[model samples]
Target: MNDQPAADTARRLTTQEAARALGVKPATVYAYVSRGRLTNRRDPVGRGSTFDAGEVEALALRSRREAAAPAGELSVRTSLTLIEDDRYWFRGVDAVELASRYPYEEVAEWLWTGGPRPGARFTAPPEALAAARRAVAALPEHSGPVDRLRVAVAAAAVTDPLRFDLSEEAVLGSARSLVPTLAGALLELGAPAGDGAPVARELWSRLTAADPEPRALEVLDLALGLLTDHDLAASTLAVRVAASARAHPYAAVSAGLGALEGPLHGAAGRLAHRMLVEVLERGGAAPVVAEYLRAGRAVPGLGHRLYRGEDPRAGALFGRLADLPQAAPALAAARDVTAVMARHGLHANVDLALAVLTVSCGMRAEAGETVFAVARTAGWIAHALEEYQERPLRMRPSGQYQGPRPPQPLP
Candidate 1:
């Protein structure tokens, strides 16, 4: 006999009805189908697809549960960063202001320690760089930069006999070396590595072969600093989870990199990059934006949940990009996309701004993701450092089991 619920006999809902039940756009309903989150069948009586009402309700419930916090939600105290009033701060100082004024290395140093450490520089140890390069080089040719970075971190860890040391100084030491090692491991585009150069400069060499314009380089450095940290982001939380398990700093960073693989996270910029490129090719944003909606996909790089207005990082970058003559077309494209999205009450986010930078710089679409991974490494280490001081396994959260309660009969 079938074990199916009685609701299976209920009438099915059309795609529009399903989207309404789920409180999402009709396109998003299709996106759910594409992502395997929901299933649909073509309606014999109509052109549109139909979803089982029971299945749609179940999926909607699941989405709600995932989006809402669980009972007894976990919270952690941090001195690293704060977000409030549509602005963010690092250790109580205005983050955007700090990023605007200092170089990437200095801002990173300030995050890791209280001091700005003006003129700070990070150089990867030769042995660590060599090991990271060897491991990264062994990855499949199809591997993305973040994939290579994950391998590079693990390889660099193997070379550090003292990787297990959880002390702040040792973790800081590991962080300084690891960031650059990750940069050095990527297959360089064309720009030569500069010895003792800022992290932004070193990363530029890897992301593209285009000769660096001074103003463009400055914008890149600012981007790095702006992206250094923003409270407990998904990847930063992953780093803390690993650190709470007493994993080595390298391992914690590896955990963060793993979280970065998700499309909703690190890969968002790449999506925005491709979208902007398409806008340029099509000579307008209207058709491109409509196509995204038509495809049941959200226009990426728009509407950050955290900020009700514009994303401060995007604003900052846009202000600087306006100064670069070469970035004019791409920058205009970004503005056009935002204007189109504005009709839907969405605004540009940092991913959109980063896309403009990558497009104008002649870098590949994935270049923004690479920049994010490198810059956020410092923030991850900072979070790891904070977690190291907390009680062991403090990050573990209890599950609220909603599955079968007791055994009734054997299957």
Candidate 2:
């Protein structure tokens, strides 16, 4: 009887090949090893470690299973948005198509209600704007935009005498003003505020030193629409939990802002921005990709659990950027990075496209979070409104006792 392991059992997949089969990045393969989700055998004949092919396949299957796992307590009925088949639908409307024609004001309203109003207005009362400015100013100058936004929301709630009014009409009114007012106050905190324009334009002025291009403004508007709502994102769930307790719209949004600060959520865009900036600054994509792989860092902005192939939002935005002459160099660099990552089967997601847009438009590094926070506020309010109508405090979940049961005496 042969004691040697069968050749099939001994087969190993190189990092690149493993990543392709697993539909992730090489760094992720290393991460799986580090986390003990997979095992790697050092190749005596080759330079880099290789993974057991069978184990890699097992991990890939587990990933797919997890993606389809039942929501359990995380599931809540929401008619606001749907992300399926690599596309986002807002109330049964194609987000990409809707984004091309509408500003954030109209898109946000559509999310809140079931209908789209063509000429809806977005305005912030002068007093609320002034109060928000003072509130934002109270935060330390070093605070991130998201932190300041949270501060502003809490402060707005404090100053509003009628914040307890949670009626649908009142909520919608406050929601309309909330996003633009947050934009205005944050703008006043640093850069000069734009002349009263769309909220996207005002946000653009606040985030960059460069003059706004029409195409860039349009792109920003489209991005805002695309990002306004994604069903049950971590931050959105946080918002819903707060809203379930009958929190004011401002408080609910504050909850969301708090959650967005996590790296795995909205802040991912900022990480992606930094990565793209490094690529552009180093004047090449390969070096940056190689450096990340060497350090065993997951390449930010590539791959998503929800999208099987290209993220539709990323594809749509990248398609728009393709036509803009100003974005040519940055777009070229992004493509190079994508090409390198494609070899490992990692595709760009919305965060990557957003980073590209932010860098191309000369926005600050943290502007990605800024955009995500502001846009998602619309969704948060919509969700809050939905939660307000349901039974309060419905999010309570039971815990399973996995730990040693209170150190019971040995029998």
Listed in order, each prediction's TM-score against the native is 0.82, 0.79
Number of clashes found in candidate 1: 0
Q: Which candidate wins on TM-score? A: 1
User: Candidate 1: deviation at residue 23, Å?
Assistant: 47
Off by over 4 Å in 1: 1-72, 407-411
> Each model's C-alpha lDDT?
0.88, 0.82
lDDT of 2 by residue, 1-411 (tens): 125366854677899999898876676667566435788777667789877888888877865654455547345767788888888898889988887788888999989987878977688778888888898888887899888898778767776777789877889988887888888888532346455678888888788877777888888888898888988888889989998898988989989988888777877788888888898899999999999999999888889888888888889899989877878877888888889989788888888889988888777778988988899899999999887764467675555557885668978
Cα lDDT of candidate 1 equals 0.88
Summarize candidate 1's per-residue lDDT along 316-404 as a digit string, tens digits: 99999999998999999999999988879999999999999999999999999999999999999999887776546767667888889
Local distance difference test, candidate 2: 0.82
Clashing pairs for model 2 are: none
